[model samples]
Target: MLHVNSRTALLNNAAFSLDVPAKIENGTTYVPARVFAEAFGGTALWSEQERKATITIGLQQVFIHTEPHKHWRMSQERINVLNEKINEATDLSSYSQIRTHFRPYFTDSFINKIIYSNGIKNNAILTKKGRYYLQ
Candidate 1:
């Protein structure tokens, strides 16, 4: 959790310092993506060319576009297409297959990181409430 205008954050009961403090702008609380990702045992990659930040945790990935005007201008149809592509690519079993399918949507380095990471677990169990628990 982060306190407004503070550079200090609390994660799992431990205090961590942030390079950029959390702030409330236009009634929206914005925290540093890098710090948040690291706190959650994830990785955040920033692309200068794209003005985007990609945060990856386990099998979940989030993309944040920093440019305010561009984000508002993004079309829902484009988002749906990208989501469909991601859903289709994730259904593949082999690393090669996944890499091939995701090449168009993701950078080669990002794909390599995901494929080589030791975070993937095969012992996940489906709980009664329909949530997955890593064993």
Candidate 2:
């Protein structure tokens, strides 16, 4: 369940609550590709097997695979501007910096990385500020 603090903001957003089939391994959730490129406007995804692994996008990234953890599956840098206002009304820099913490994209590449990193390879993901949840 994508838990945005503001239910109003979620209503205004296009892809806040995406539904797709994925795998659960090692206490982490994995999402599908549609949840990435189509859902959150992540960069492009390509496979090494599919002709030298070429995916072109405005952002610079080598490649990404699922890492497996609770975070969504994409890179924030590639996604559109997320109007996360956690600290928008607050006078605290600590709150203002919340946006700085979440990679916060539902991209195929990001999801792929998380799955590969966590479930496949078994690594520990450092926590970010935004809450991690399932949808």
Candidate 3:
């Protein structure tokens, strides 16, 4: 476990020292990935050229990019447009209507949910279908 603004971490009741303390910014907790990975018996490799970190634990590998996504500006614009639409909507009765108006900004899976599923609630049918799809 990690405490905010603290450089000490505890694992199995053992204290581990850190070069930098964990911090919270904009309601998000930020910890040294290298220290956490090493504490958990994993290895973290940094790529300066790619601006990314490759973390490996046993047979699994996870990649984390440090830079913003390529489409960040475009996504922000889309979100602004969606927010404007939401703010302007005064007569919208149902979520389906709002979703229909915002369909162009949604992904295929989200569109499928709006088209196929009844709402956001996960009933037994959706749960079974989700499990089957995962399998």
Candidate 4:
């Protein structure tokens, strides 16, 4: 057996191989740009204006610049109305309303038991995967 230290051995043993990369930052691993470019069907470029250090990506470009008007805001009156409706909805128990709506669905035995056994006014009983309150 022979013990050999080689760069080829290290590269072969490495978890990943470097190919031309998508992104590169200074003081960090410089990825191969060409591999990602081919993979994504795009191109990477170097710019002299950017001092050649910054990697400029995406050659075929679509730059749509549009400034939306910021004046459209919900009014205080609208906010107040929304808040009032929410409060009205969440203020009371839905069980009473459910009972009133589906009173015909409850049997006489269950209603009699509910009436005698503890104040089950707002108490709900699960029936057929739906909820019904004791009237």
Maximum-TM-score candidate: 1
Flag the better candidate by TM-score, 1 or 3.
1
lDDT assessment of candidate 3: 0.66
In angstroms, the error of model 2 at 94 is 62
Prediction 2 TM-score vs. true: 0.25
TM values, all candidates: 0.43, 0.25, 0.42, 0.25
Root-mean-square deviation of Cα positions for candidate 2 versus the true structure, in angstroms: 18.7
lDDT of 4 by residue, 12-128 (tens): 344333332323346454334433343455654544444333223455542223343345555555545533433333323444653343245345555444445432444332222
Give stretches of model 4 more than 4 Å off.
1-59, 68-71, 95-135
The whole-model lDDT of each prediction reads 0.70, 0.39, 0.66, 0.39
Model 2: residue 62 alpha-carbon error in angstroms:
4.3
Clashing pairs in 1: none
- For candidate 2, which ten residues in a row score worst on lDDT? 83-92
State the weakest 10-residue window (summed lDDT) of model 4. Answer: 1-10
lDDT of 3 at 30: 87
Decoy 4 TM-score against native:
0.25
The number of the candidate with the highest lDDT is 1
Candidate 1 similarity to native, TM-score: 0.43
C-alpha positional error of residue 7 in candidate 4 after TM-score superposition, expressed in Å: 37
Deviating ranges (above 4 Å) for candidate 1: 68-135
Flag regions of model 3 displaced more than 4 Å: 68-135
